[model samples]
Target: MRRSKNRGFGIALGVAIGTSVGVAVNQVAVSIAIGIVVGLIFGSILDKRSQQQEK
Candidate 1:
């Protein structure tokens, strides 16, 4: 449950950051897509680490 929440938060945070960067670079769509991918990767890594720590 907590892991899911973290993943969601990461994605949301990515969106926000991506939007800002996109606006600066004039590539909103591409930035958002990249952001989502990066967020997912980071989120999954975090989840894995958390799970490991729980053991």
Candidate 2:
């Protein structure tokens, strides 16, 4: 449960950062979409790391 929550937080943080950076770079739509994708990828990576740690 704690691990899941942490993963969720990580994902949200990634998305927020990615979107903000994208917007700052002036690539609005494309940046947002890319940000979302990258966020998901990063979230999954974090999840994997957490799982490995648990074991």
Among the numbered candidates, top TM-score falls to: 1
What is the Cα-based TM-score of model 2? 0.62
lDDT of 1: 0.87
User: Where does model 1 exceed 4 Å of error?
Assistant: none
Estimate every model's Cα lDDT from 0 to 1: 0.87, 0.72
* Least well predicted 10-residue stretch by lDDT in candidate 1: 34-43
- Estimated TM-score for each candidate: 0.83, 0.62
Candidate 2: list runs displaced more than 4 Å: 1-11
For this target, which candidate reaches the highest lDDT against the unseen true structure? 1
